[model samples]
Target: MISVGVDVGNKFTKAVVLKDGQVISKSIVLSGFDQKQSANEAYDQAIKEAGISKNDVNYVLATGAGKKEVDFANDVVSEVGAGARGAVYFFPSGRTIIDVGAEDGRASKCDQNGKIVDFAVNEKCAAGAGSFSESMARALEVPLEEIGPLALQSNNVIYMNAQCTVFAESEVVSLIHAKTSKADISKAVHDAIAARIISMARRVGVEKDLVMIGGVGNNVGFLKALGDGLEIEVLVPDKPEYVCAIGAALIAAERN
Candidate 1:
């Protein structure tokens, strides 16, 4: 059986095609101003990559912040539920999941079977999410993709005190004006976010085989900071940002 999953996130839409319990293809695109359009584009792209026609899909499931906007989906799943299932699929031994998306961050404790036990989230602000780093990179006049590598070059760990995105912007500017090294500033920004993420994860109770997912998981510097802050090895899957969509596709397979 072939199944498709769509995840409409705040900043990006992700699609996955699963066949016979394996992910055959996936696609990601900026959400832009039209969520539905982006979802369709992602789904269509994945189908094309898999060399499958739309009619070939047996089921379609949608997940994420904008999941409800995907009118064509057969059903929808909570982002947290999808994330937990997807992460477990990649790391079967994982019991704790840390997902840092564009707009928010989540920490979930799950069973060996990928069932959620408890969870905590930091959604009130962007300070603990990917947007924070993106904004910081912009302030430093560096590409977001380069921020992680630049941070890795830091010989000293500068401390960032701002806990709010708006305030952090000013702090970053001040640091820049003070002639702070970009590498140190980058490390500071990620460290601040890491501290917040670790706190949220701890509330849900951290356990062995911790996994990190979502777009921010692509940031090696952030991952390193998170690992150090939590004092645990962070396991990440390939294309970690697509994990939620992958989970939704897996769910579609199960229902079929």
Candidate 2:
């Protein structure tokens, strides 16, 4: 069966095309003002890459913050469910899942079969999501892609006390005025975000074989901080941002 999945997230929209159980093509596009347009663009790109027409697809599923905006989807799944299913597809041993995107962070405890047992979410807070790192990177005059690697070079442990993104930006400015190294400040930013994620994960009862999937999973500094804070290795699948889309496609195949 050929199935397609479109995930319309806050920052980006992703689409994946799968043939039977294997991924054939995937696409990602910035989610601008119109989520529906973004979703359609991503889906079109994926279909083109896969050399298939919309008529060839057997099912189309949507998931993520803007899932409801996908008017063409045959069905919709919650982010938690899609995330858990995707994580398990990559690592059957993954029982605890953490997904951190542009605007929210979530943790879920799932069984071996990808059935969610418990879950927790940190939403509507920039401080608990990737936007916090983006804001801090901007304040430090560092490129978003370089900030993660820069944080890994710091040996000093600097703590950031501010919990709000607005206050945290000011704190970053203060650190700069105090002649704090950019690396140290970067580390502090990652540590702060990791702390919040760890706290949320704890609420759902963290377990071994933990997996992290989302756009933020690509941030090495944040990944290191999260692992260190949790005292456990966090597994990340290739192209982590597409996991939810892939999961949605898998579900489409299963449902049909």
Candidate 3:
């Protein structure tokens, strides 16, 4: 039997196909407002890669903000559960997961077997997210990928007085005018993001083998900051951005 799981994250839709409890194929597809179309494309790509027909995918699970857009899904699940499951799958010793996406971030504590025991989330702020960094990059004329690596090279002062996204952007501009290198300003931005993620991690009580997932995990600077603030090394999945989809696939395996 084959099962398909897809995570419709704010910026991307990720799909994973599992056969007899092992992942056989996966796809990360760019998302659109008509979420259903994006989900279908994700599944199409997964099926094509697996050399299977749509009918061969016995069950489908969906999670994340745009999950409902997965018209063919058999179950619509919570992102927290998916993250927890995905974390344990990657690091069997994982006890905590900090997932930062485009609009929100959260922390979850799970048992050794990966069942969520407690969780905390921040849906009201965009301070420590991938979107915030992307916005800063665009305003600063710096590429997103270079934000972290370059930020590490700066020796200037860190400046971000407020955690609000609007205020932070304005502050970034002020720093720029003060002759601060984009790298320094970027590092401060990531420091702010790390603080937010650490705050969330503390809410759930930080634990060993901590896993960081979602789009933000792809940012080296932010992850490094997270590792620094939490005082516990964080484990990044081989595909940091696909942890949610991988977790969904694990859930599908459990169902079977």
| lDDT for position 78 in model 1 | 85
Instruction: Score candidate 3 by TM-score against the native.
Output: 0.96
lDDT of each: 0.92, 0.95, 0.86
Error of 1 at 203 (Å): 0.5
Q: Is candidate 1 or candidate 2 better by lDDT?
A: 2
Q: What TM-score quantifies how close candidate 2 is to the native fold?
A: 0.99
lDDT, residue 164, candidate 3: 83
For model 3, the stretches where C-alpha displacement exceeds 4 angstroms are 155-159
- TM-score of every candidate: 0.98, 0.99, 0.96
Q: For every model in order, what is the number of clashing pairs?
A: 0, 0, 0
Candidate 1: stretches off by over 4 Å: none
Regions of candidate 2 where Cα sits further than 4 Å from its true position: none
Worst 10 contiguous positions by lDDT, candidate 2: 121-130
- Candidate 3, residues 1-256, lDDT tens digits: the string is 7888899988899999988878889998888677889999999999999989988877899998899888899998899999889888889999998999988898999998889999998877788777888888877889888887876776555758978888888888888999887888988988888888888789789888898888888888887778877778889888777888888887886676
Which pairs, if any, clash in model 3?
A: none
Model 3 lDDT-worst window of ten: 150-159
Please give me the total number of clashing residue pairs in predicted model 1: 0
